[model samples]
Target chain A: MECTDFKLIVVGGSAGSFSVVSHLLAGLRPDFKLPIVLSLHRLKHVRSGLVEGLSLKSKLRVIEPNDKEKLQQNTVYLAPANYHLFVELDGTVALSTEESHNHSRPSIDHTLGSAAYAYRDKLLGILLTGANRDGAAGMKEIADNKGFTIVQDPLSCDIDTMPKEALKLFRPDRLMNPEDILHFLNALPG
Target chain B: MQNSEKDYNYKEYLLILKECSPYDFSEYSDNSIDRRIKKIMRDQGLNMEELVLKTRTEPDFVEQVVEAITVNTTELFRDPDVWNHILKKVLPALKHQKKINIWHAGCSTGQEVYSLLILLDHLQILDRAEIYATDISKKALEQAKKGQYFYNFNAEKYRENFKASFEGETVPDFDSYFSADADKDLLKIRTDFSEKVQFIKHDLVKGDLPFYNKFDLIFCRNVLIYFQGSLQSKIVERFHENLFPGGTMILGSHESLGGFFKTKFSKNGPVYHRTNSFHFKY
Candidate 1:
């Protein structure tokens, strides 16, 4: 698919993701137009105010996704605290609790893999700082469907496990620091 | 019935795993498979033969089963000591390579790529490096390309690890990396360094290698543990083919190339080099 047609961008992380996310957004421009989603693995009991916290660093509006929320360009959506977020065929968000995959409810795999299937070539998958391999298979699904893939350099990550795991499993298109990733996204034709 | 006489049904599960998914549980350690299978049975409420029968009749069930069995839990630089090792040993050794090609296979979301980029940027080699990051999941890839992460969730851990990695040195202020918007929804990466890297879609299981057997350095860390011995062996063979002569390969700290290949290369910490003749074990 044409690069401009790539409307969906998903970012997955768990532990140590905040700084990576902060660094990435610090480099991005306000005019960025893709629909960015954050799927962070969290404890069921923990209150995930990620959308509110990250809004401080980003130019786009950030909010926790609501049921059947229609995805829009230049907006950032966070997967709700306890549900897996998916991209519907009509370019809207769908939430589910249909059992956890890889021991995660708001699993990076479920959200990302499902989005890959729905968005196909118009998707971009990003795996950031996390402690587990939650996003690895989802990253693979993105590539299989001909979507762009990027991984934070594990060496620079606060917790290298997730990025390191991904580096070992799939061949991503780029390996960059958060700064570089921010720069790249800001430069996108959006 | 005797202990041995009880129906293990090993062959049936093996056939199912081989035919249905890319995983081959047959050659895996029996204890690991047994534990995983037990968990699968317990979770799905199925016995061994029943699970096999369900798989045969329901193709979608196989996807759930594969998801259950794979060891997908990971973090960014799960093992920081390994990164320390690379920083102290591997990067210094490769200082001479003018233009570097680094492949971070299975880069779920761009965390590890950012980590490596930070290292390269510090070492003054990032400009000369071309990092090829790939994965099988497009969702993860999309996240990786965007490079935006959750600030409040990861800041503390990032600071702690950053201190450990730098040993109290003044590191980059991560907060300065992103800008907050009016609605607090969108985050974008700055353009300065983002232009250097390229994000693409690639599947190692079924797709062709991009560099065509000429990567200068490859990082294939903890991913092989999910594959059975045969598939792991095949992937290692592919890695061997993808690397240039005397190129480097980095694996996870817990993982080793034991019995997978016969090669003579100096183990520089977690990184392995291809010295003389590189053979494809498969």
Candidate 2:
């Protein structure tokens, strides 16, 4: 599917998904103007390292935002460990320590739900391979709100539980492999 | 253009909230507050005009609004290891003191305060402990003071959390804390457990701490992560000044002291010890 006109891109993943994320980030143009927010499941106790890890491979600037930091174009923002990240109606970031939903902080459901509310049809939501079902309901929310939604092809995932769960919840606008998603993001108007 | 419109709506709503309630949310992180307000609006199916009008005209409507915006999520024996650390290393050091002054800042619904109290009671030190629990949300403080919770306490989660608190120690009976109410819809902690706790309504972000020069231990968990970086540092400084020399402060598992306060306290997982006397550096 060829798509554009999105203001924000949200990506959620868990176990065995980092390599796909890294590959996708490496392929995106350095000047890609849409703000991309990532909500990868992380160890709740440790801080740091993850952003640095992603930044090493990403062409775009990678950052972990402080509470209330404004979303900026061409930057990749990762949710900090142990805090649930949210998007505000005015397009800034909010962090919450509310009880872990689906047994994970930075749960995909919370982030995507907020983004779906804030950006509506202007959001592109992507769910990748994960061991848990955290992103299923969130992807559903995005699709329900008229935002474009995509899931990594379950047959190709190292772990299919997450994408399979999303498939069970709602039909996504596109089902892709890592390379297709990379090209899709790169093809968006800069 | 869309962003500007949302920004205008957000600021106006916050102004309405400030005028209608005792708390000022203006200084709290803006995006967090805005998202929460939007969540409330979405849940209630109300537009900004409806929300503002209801907030102005409806009595106790503002309370529900405040509760919705404020982060009150907590659990019994949260991060049990922190409690274990306090019980093992911190409390014995204060055992000889004739009086213990403890403050649980942003003590949402009072679970951490009561957890500490239960530990003190187990150690047979409750008689000398003076506990102060404070939160910015009056609704939360009211629930805390009432100590009655609908939706029965989860004994299994409680047991699991307690088991994780200590290494190889026999688990305490979690059932002892809660008894069913007449309707069987709620589980209320025995009133005697909270008899010594003094619940106060205080804002940690915009206002001065309610007390000065008296706390031996302070528990301000999960609350700091909600704030912006500067506010976190400021509140940590206030915590330092409030704590007695050699006293201990416990932050949430995810939070830590920033800047120079990092030097003022020695850290142990989630616990920090005030080293020597502190002088607030302007």
State which candidate has the highest DockQ: 2
Q: Candidate 1 lDDT, tens digit per residue, A1-190?
A: 3364677899999888877776666557778788888898775445445666788877778877654567987788888765667776677675543346677868898788878877878898899988888899888899888989999888778888888888787899888888778777877785
Deviation (Å) of B131 in candidate 2: 0.2
Deviating ranges (above 4 Å) for candidate 2:
A1-11, A14-83, A87-94, A99-105, A113-125, A129-150, A156-174, A177-190, B150-153, B168-170, B180-186, B206-213, B277-280
Best by TM-score: 2
lDDT, residue B14, model 2: 80
Model 2 Cα lDDT, one tens digit per residue, A27-103: 88888899999999975444458888898899999988866678999999998876899887778887788768899
B168-222 per-residue lDDT for model 2 (tens digits): 5555665677676646766567688766799998878665766554689988988
**Ten-residue stretch with the least lDDT total in model 2 chain B:** B150-159
User: Fraction of true contacts kept, per model?
Assistant: 0.00, 0.48
The CAPRI-style docking tier of model 2 reads: acceptable
Score candidate 1 by lDDT. Answer: 0.70
Report the C-alpha lDDT of model 1 over B1-282, residue by residue, as the tens digit. 332332266555866767866655565533345546768999889887798888878877876775565443334444556666666667766787888888988776666666677667767787888888876555666777887656555545554554455543456654454343425554334454455556666655654776545787788765664454566676777787778777888876545565446454457666788766635433
**Cα distance off (Å), candidate 1, residue A172:** 51
The residue-level lDDT of candidate 2 at A88 comes to 79
Clashing pairs in 2: none
User: lDDT of all the models against the reference?
Assistant: 0.70, 0.83
> What's the alpha carbon RMSD for model 2?
6.0
* Most lDDT-accurate candidate: 2
